[model samples]
Target: MASSSDPKLPPLMKAQFLEAFNKPYVLRSVPLPTVTDPHDMLIKVDAASYCHTDAVLAAGQMRPNPPSFPHIGCHEFAGTVVALPEISTSPFQVGDRVGVPGRAFHPCGTCFECASSPTAEDADADPPGYSVYCPRSQNNGIDAPGGFREYAAVDSRQVAPIPENLSAVDTAVLMCAGVTVYAALKRCRLKPGQRVGIMGCGGGLGHLGLQFAVQMGLEVWGVDNADAPLRLAGEVASGARVIDARNVDATEVVARLGREDGKQDRGDMGLDAVIILPESQDAFDYGVSLLRNHGKCIVVSFPERGFHVSARDVVFRDISIIGSLVGSNKLLRETLQFAAQNNVRAVIRTFPLSRLNDLVAEYHKGRGGKLVIDMALSDGS
Candidate 1:
């Protein structure tokens, strides 16, 4: 029974707990988590960040719900390996920087979803790269305890080693926010020089999506409800065309985007694709409306109710509304690497773990970039 009993590690650690719905998280001292599986490695969390889904989870509204109450608050976490389990043959060792992206934790590689080859030329494949859809899988932060705690027991197979160039905090935000939108944008399948509109293009996911779209060689027009997000998007991707919906009407925006040739005549020549990233159903309808024939409407967030997309428009216009979850393990690695090489980084405002509630309150009100709890810093800077 000689597991990772590092004397340097404390038996108990401080963790965030959402004791009840619609209440602030309470910090409690709990016993350190232990490695259960052979491949599970104990990690000392260096940083973690909250997303829009954290609020929904705290409200007790998210479906298929978290495993239990007093749930840990963040899926986006990055840290250094502190201890390795016995019998683990994985190359990972203590002191290695790594991140667990919280989706597809225990992917049964034998299942139909996981077994299906992405390189296979079978067009009838049952949806390739849906890594989170494995029937026997459980997510790190959502369906189980997340990384708000000081330490976590993670599967080595599921964790991605941090690139030498990326810090733990930047890698943390990229885990959830970056991967979600990266997956959604890829769903569009638009070739280079093609047009794609990203709804909610200024928020955390939107900003990353705009930059990724630019890197992918697509002509991206990003639309936000206000000017602040547009500013953020502009700062991230110089190639992106940032649009403020408040300043310009949606119809006019759609018309302007359609007229890529600058002719200004309103017609059916709309965007080639629209990647919807906002957590509003109205965005779904609006995204569908902005698409041309056979254009894709990639849905990313979960609104309160279902989308009110027009059936007639979907049928006649051949609008394909695709629902995307987080990206596959391979895609997540690619995003982290692409971000490192391309200088694509999240605009983060850091605070210590003590100020998580403060950030959450401000985040609920909405903001640009990602909010992070820097465990390495004592003050809530």
Candidate 2:
């Protein structure tokens, strides 16, 4: 914890990152983020999450603006606000525990898109339709130093105050992965008694999606490759169903869901929507096959390889494919509330921020649930 009066704090803070793609994230010293504007605040990072996107950044692909040699990248983190601007309308006060979604530090609210349903619409809208095709993407990792450090600077609009009682590790994933899924589900226009299928439900974001879908009055069917992730997904989303992605036939599984299954008593075409979060193109292909007519597939992953869909299949099925980003500040707040209310959270393996490089390698193994970097560790653990 840091005090607002600590003007003598270190000029630089410890961070971890790879100098380039296909390298390791190692500890290095970087300038502590400073608050230069009234809407800006400095946070003492308590915990942060490592998503698949972080892995891609480490691997040197899909980074919008690759940081120069020795970059720090971590987009999702929970912390305490230690500094505040002189004049602000944000509900947050200094000392408030909060989470910063490692996108941009702040958003420009004056953009035409941001003005209309700012929380639901893209803020990068320019010239209407022209901007729709190429939404203005904010630069966080490339343009600004991201989390993965002891402290971060965030714009008030990009910050969400988290419940003090929630575990920082669990809430950390919510900052990015959790909020992304929640936002995608909202876009699905889900209804009570609707059947929802989540591909890659064992994943960090997928697992949270399953939990959210179940709590939101949908019957969830989680599909994943591993037995452990499948079992864990079921545990996280009580009464939600699971399918073995590697072995199960997509059409057969959809058929089973349509018919009453003894285990969950779910029947088929019963599905109203589906969300896909996978790094592989095959998952996208399979997700389309499982949807019922008029079902929506909300995609929230950036695959290393591009996805190719058959025009005939899409046209005939009346299925819709949509993409979503991390989420708006309003959605982030809703994520916190949903998690607090339903006890939905990430199953995290904690590591001291000091051991970030080594942990990045470990996370690459893909055996853990979620890995959280605890920046507040004593002596860097």
Candidate 3:
């Protein structure tokens, strides 16, 4: 291990590790991570957000390469830098509020994706950049260790500074939900004033997507059949037309969408794009039905098996079905900045680390918002 760390820190810290597939996590006192690489930083992880990916991993459903046994969970983490690297030129400093996005880590500098860093391009080093397409990169919590502990060692190069208005709890969601939907919106390629539909609008990512879509100047329609999620959609984006897909007829939704500006346009002139978040095939098909010709259908959900879309409709309407993963490092920074300036935030319920097993048990039973583990709440909550 790298010796470059705070000598005053403790040797070990509490963490939750997935000891086996299809089993509950085990608590252990693991050695605290150290800042080894010049681009590394040791973080006192304040908050780690639970995600669907964690549920998938727990179910032994990870595709291609499986996660190692006894792996640390939680890819969406935010914290203060307790120990900084020896390198002075890094963007971060000691005590900087930061977050490491789940998908963008361990980027090989020479790759084409890393070279496409949106914010800055450097000659001597690979700038803190995107690794979404980097073949050699390791996804945090999958191929590499993640933040499910009191403290975590992270790749500083892939970390985004948290906005001052946000706490680590809120920033944790930004790492996953915010960056994810933002990247999905980018993939939609919808212009300002065009219409966009968010299929799972009441959940954590969906509500946040509504906020971001409105801020992006797109007219929004949020779809959810459940009571809790529809309530959340109304609470977060009051201006949006929140539709209950179970009750509302598709023609009515399309008609209402067409008449938004009082011009009474054709019902078939539907949304410019649809951002799908749920895993249900019915939801996917309904979302596609709401799209106009040549509309972009951006898929964000990853079910055990994929959902089916009508091939005839897709070909006839010229709809572009695209898959959007989490954003690159540069997109994470941009996403946080947007959230900070626009007051966009996640409505999260905080639980102490000790209650992780309880949360994991109920994770897929159907909830509407974000759940997070707050390290500060270590008081047996």
Specify the poorest-scoring 10-residue window by lDDT in model 2: 124-133
Query: 273, model 2: CA deviation in Å?
Result: 1.3
Task: Name the lDDT value of residue 288 in candidate 3.
Answer: 88
Q: lDDT per residue, candidate 3, 341-376, as tens digits?
A: 988888788888878888776666556778889988
lDDT of each: 0.80, 0.73, 0.82
For model 1, residues 130-237, the per-residue Cα lDDT tens digits are: 456788877787877888888887777777889999999999999999988887777777789998988988898988888888998999888888667777888887
Quick one: ranking by lDDT, best first? 3, 1, 2
Model 2 clash pairs are: 21-60, 75-102, 257-267, 257-268, 258-267, 258-268
- Mark the 10 consecutive residues where model 3 has the least summed lDDT: 119-128
TM-score, structure 1 vs. true: 0.92
Between the candidate structures 1 and 2, which one is better when assessed by lDDT? 1
Residue-level lDDT for 207 in candidate 3: 93
Q: Which structure among the candidates has the greatest TM-score? A: 1
Which is better, 2 or 3, measured by TM-score? 3
RMSD of each: 2.7, 4.4, 3.4
